[model samples]
Target: MTQAAYEHNGRSVERAAFYAIACDPRRSIAVEACAGAGKTWMLVSRILRALLEGSLAKDGHGVQAHEILAITFTKKAAGEMRQRLNEWLVEFAQAPPEKLAAELLARGVPPAQIAAQAPALQNLYPQLLASARPVQIRTFHSWFAALLRTAPLAVLQDLGLPANYSLLEDDTEAITAVWARFYATVVDSPSARADFEALVAVHGRFQAHKALGAALNKRVEFVLADAQGVVDASVPPFDAQFPAFAGLAAPEDLLWAQRPLLQEAAGNLGRASAVTFSAAGSALEQALTAHDADAVLAALLTQKGTARKFGEKIVGIATVRAAQELALQVAQAQLQHAAWAHQQRMARLTRVLIAELASLKYERGWVDMNDVERAASVMLSDPVLSGWVQERLDAKVKHLLIDEFQDTSPLQWQALHAWLSGYAGAAGAPSVFIVGDPKQS
Candidate 1:
């Protein structure tokens, strides 16, 4: 924006402070974006501001370019952030390498050296000509999952997972399913059932999955209490596989495992219980009985208004965002099968219930399917997973953004509050943005 435009369309002092910090070589702020606050515009402006102010400069030391990290919570959002930021910077800089070089020189970045580096940033931004460096951003969990796939040791150590277990070779699912089965058995007892059911009632099932993921990730790598429990396994050699360093594992992690939400769950119990069995049964039955079963199918396949609304609210949230994806899945799917004209909706809902029964057989999935559910179960069983995820998150970000704050799973909130409150001291600490519509929650 021009000086005049900036003056006329002045952002709030806090937002301007965000711009300044994002632009400046130092300083980072956590911004709570109220509704309609133009978060996208701000993100774009910050990227442009950083580029214009020489934040993209790669000095001889080679540290500055890689120093800054911007993390969002979802794949779609991350991509949008990168594209918008890149496009804004490219257009603002005249959509050409020469323009960037000239600006870099004007900023006293050493004309000769900047001429070379400017081409890189220009190409790297993706809005311009192609080059090499990734001058953009990533989701937090994605980056970590990549770390796990590549240098499993470093990633594990960083997250404090097992130092010795093979992240890839070990089947964390096998471990988790055993625990979940045991949990079910134990819960069958009157006292155990109350506490177990109570756990679900108090927290959501998703939190349990997260806890399960954490536990298995640790047992495989860090602590195998019984040598008897050790199951020898083999995965392709690290060299034979794609390098995880390049951010390859991230998209897959999100697409399949809902890793970000699971990662956040660490020790939270909200995932398993927020929508209790009572709620699910009632919602499912009411939904199925309310509509013609055949009509429900027609509505879904035909993209009718009712189905669309349900999908937008629930599916859109889960698939696009980390905070509400699972909840969205449950809510939307329930809605989808609710509007039955005949027995169709009831049949579908019945299938949904049956689907969970055999889900135990698989221990991994692309979309937190039955398999990933098992992995999540292991995470809840293990305490170390939470610590490990906590460690990884603590190590990287300087800021955190939470959504649906009022309904935040207790375990997830505890970790977040603790970390934001200074679990890592001031160094590399993340500023926090907590945003939620409490009434909606």
Candidate 2:
């Protein structure tokens, strides 16, 4: 069918060609319709066309009522869709072809096409009603939950749990309890004690506690990389990994050998290197005074990069340049290891916390919404279980309709994509129909 343009208030408005696209029942359609632009009417019409045309059927009279899955974001929206679908079925069951044709024509369908399909629609409604055991209209979460319930054994197997678990109504108490357990252990455990000491040494006790608390909150969303086994308790140690700063020429060796300006720069560097109170600072200071290139390099390595105020002793142009250079090196070093201990501690702590949290939930046969999605995602990712799921759904669902597509999470999408794309028969794979407004998503 060709695209149609009609007059709307005072201007020409191009009518959406959704009827033609949706009527084909061969390809998927994703519509981003504005509010009050007949999105519901269009979707209902598309679903009705799929039913009347018997296009979703593999080798039968037509697709069953339960074969069409329509998912919306809200329970209210799902109710409305189910209600409207029921109304459409009833209307076709009772109305004559001419009347049905008139209604289709009003909805922008071609006259001849509507007349041809109206009779079939009238004939198909009774069977559709008879076969409607469970209406497949549901909110996204409810649908995913239903999928888990459908394949409980497969879900448990895929997640490697002993049996199916009950979902917790709320995770607040569970989270707090698990956190308390981890906190108590960390306060007394040997490894945790060492981490705490190191962290305190670098950032002080009060600052360390604040920093650790912040890191804990942030680590909740951190997924372990594949290489880092999920149960890996150890974090990479910073001290062992820090490059050994040895066998290097001093800063003066590189800059002092050039000219008067270079020698002045070296002198300034020497003065800047001597300002800190650390052993490295003292060694760097001695080496600078004695002009020992190798010793200066060694001391620079040991220096933790602290700065001091030197009122008028630092004055020359080269001296200023040398001070900036020193400050940059010191500042870079400090920034690099500023939270080295905290990070290592947090990584170890987070892994333990996550493991403990899972253990607590599993021991109690409880899971949260996130756990629900995770299990569902695992089921979809598994070849055997995913195939089984797809086979079951393929026989029941032929068209996938989603409302509020923009609000779909990655895991939710993964579950849906797996089922829809994994249908066994190649000839009649389910078509996806999505509608939403980006502005309101």
Candidate 3:
């Protein structure tokens, strides 16, 4: 065989071996594969195996159609998976014995057991069609919405949501309206106006609006971070000290005091290393003469705040070396302070924006996907409500297959973890199959 063909066949065999283990119904598994690696095919294969083996079901008579839940990242993916699974079942039911045996073997059933598996494979189509509750294949949002429907009215009231709240698929108009109201309120309130002005001064009006919009889009993440105490709003103080320039309170003052010495050193280095030092020397001279601290630091250090090379000719000059080191330290400290200040501003702005948006949503009786996820998480975590929710979910689903798992948000994972935590090692515990490609994510 050609080398390329041989290598391709080798990979095929390896993937088949992996499928054998990953598709086993008795074991819960997680698989990460690159795009075009047949993740959908593997997911479908696992479902079929679980149904045929019946080991994952509490009743031990094979998993029913209603007992299996498949969650996908997008609606189109969920649709595609459902279509593929149905097509496979139809094909399996009609194929002749030999064809059925080949299909079974290809799906990871042992060759010795293919004949014994044929009857169950043929029966799956009719079984699914007769099921009172068809298998649920839904996007994460869709599944969460369905779960929320089962929540008690008292719980919904606790979440500040109406009994029949409408899902806002597109929240653009609502967000724009909230922003206008927020801007008006900020103008009317002196304290809020000051914060707005500071934010606008740092980022300019357009960028400031854009930053706030981005923060609103990631409100869920901010809420989770705040709850975990991972976000610190206090601005970090710039405390870098330079012993070489002890009395100089500012970088510009230090540069001005050492102007004569720096100019002489730069002149010498420029003459020795014209290609590397000439441009920096000229810029340094101009900045020092201008008495601009930021410009002087930029000339003395690289963009990453590292001191520029001064060449062998100027290395032995102690005073010049100390000045360069001091400039680098000042640049580093200034950068840190600026970053911390920006983060604090963004955090403060985001908090206000989220509050305004929440009020708007509440007033309109609207809930977005983020709200759905949060509500679901709250329901799953509540000590009293969780037991009730678990009982309902346990009766309906015994196997979970999550596709595009890498794209799942932290909040979604938290809810799933809370819901599944108690089932570990318990009687009739559900089996989970997760597959995704991190590279794709």
Candidate 4:
């Protein structure tokens, strides 16, 4: 049977790959198609090829058949991409297999068997395959989130808790609990106490600082589950594990690719990042630091990248300005939610316990960035969390596929790197496939 040949739009790297792919399929290639180069069209074909080849089948010992993970920059993009893929599948499905076979031969796919699969390609193929078997198609965030949810359930069970215990909704919330427990366990340790004291000195209060700490501990719980009882049981007792937060592989494991960069920027900041500023400084102080016209020029160029390091710095200042804007927005939103909740907690305030929301915010205990950075830093840097996350990645998938490579944060990428390092150390495994648009950077 023949396969479809891509319509050319001059020199698309994706075109080269597409021709080669229609000739023969490979997983590690990047399709560097520019705008109007039919990148999405090619993307649809790649997915179809994967599906026809039984790579989408889940009831296998070899190739994975689970729903292909597709991630795009926006919810709209994802929807459009899914719709297009379905439409193409149906289009191909409606065509006679013999005609498609001739078409494949005329275009490229000479596989005698591939034509047989064409009739199997229905618009409902994804849905039918998913229902009859196990197929899923979801954006990256949604799927990873589901995995994250399952991770903790495995952890709590490993910790020997009652069977009915469930993982929490937010990782930050769970981490707070675990770190509180960790602190309770380690209160007497001389070094731990000294460190705790140092934090109190700088921050004004030493009590109730385990928000993200507990978050990482919750990660530990999941790692233990992956191990099936291999982690050191004596290190600490997790009354509740951080099942949602699987410590990522390692920093370097994340690629400096475009997709990751966008993912991080969008997921973390609603499509904005540190590069949003166009002023000399994110704050007026920065503008004042510059001398004369060069400073003004630099500030003007601050929102974007430049040829020199100075330009980059200027652009970075713009990003800082952008961050400030974002922070203000977040602060405003949080204040409203917290204030309303505070009022409810007080319930017609009058006495001290029932006073205004401000009093309650201070009295009832709350956490912010300080707690998040400190605790997450500890768990991620720890030997146990890093080791366990790497092992799980290596054990779960023979191939590592990461999307939105450019938008991955340094910390998040590091988690994947740690895993890759471990995999390379072990040998006989695939190196991570990092794909994304550098132009998007």
Compute each candidate's TM-score over C-alphas. 0.36, 0.68, 0.77, 0.39
Per-residue error for 172 in candidate 1, Å, reads: 17
After superposition, the stretches of candidate 3 with alpha carbons farther than 4 Å from their true spots are 1-16, 55-61, 152-160, 233-235, 239-331, 381-384
Model 2 TM-score on a 0 to 1 scale = 0.68
List, residue by residue over 135-200, the lDDT tens digit for candidate 2: 478877676666667575745764544465776646776677786777677787889767767767
What residue runs in model 4 are displaced by over 4 Å at the alpha carbon? 1-18, 22-26, 55-64, 102-127, 130-135, 153-404, 416-435
Per-residue lDDT for 125-209 in model 3, tens only? 8877876777778899998887787799887777667776789877887888998878887888787788889989987999999
Q: What TM value does model 1 have?
A: 0.36
Give the alpha-carbon lDDT of every model.
Answer: 0.40, 0.61, 0.76, 0.40
Task: Name the best candidate (by lDDT).
Answer: 3
- Give the per-residue Cα lDDT of candidate 3 at 33: 76
Off by over 4 Å in 1: 1-25, 51-58, 62-67, 93-136, 147-441
Model 2 spans > 4 angstroms off: 1-13, 22-24, 35-38, 55-61, 91-99, 106-109, 122-125, 150-162, 193-221, 224-266, 269-323, 339-344, 392-394, 418-425
Clashing residue pairs found in predicted model 2 = none
CA displacement after TM-score superposition, residue 63 of candidate 3 (Å): 2.3
The clash numbers for all candidates, in the given order, read: 45, 0, 1, 48
Q: The CA-based lDDT of model 4 is what? A: 0.40
Residue 318 in candidate 3, Cα distance off native in Å:
5.5
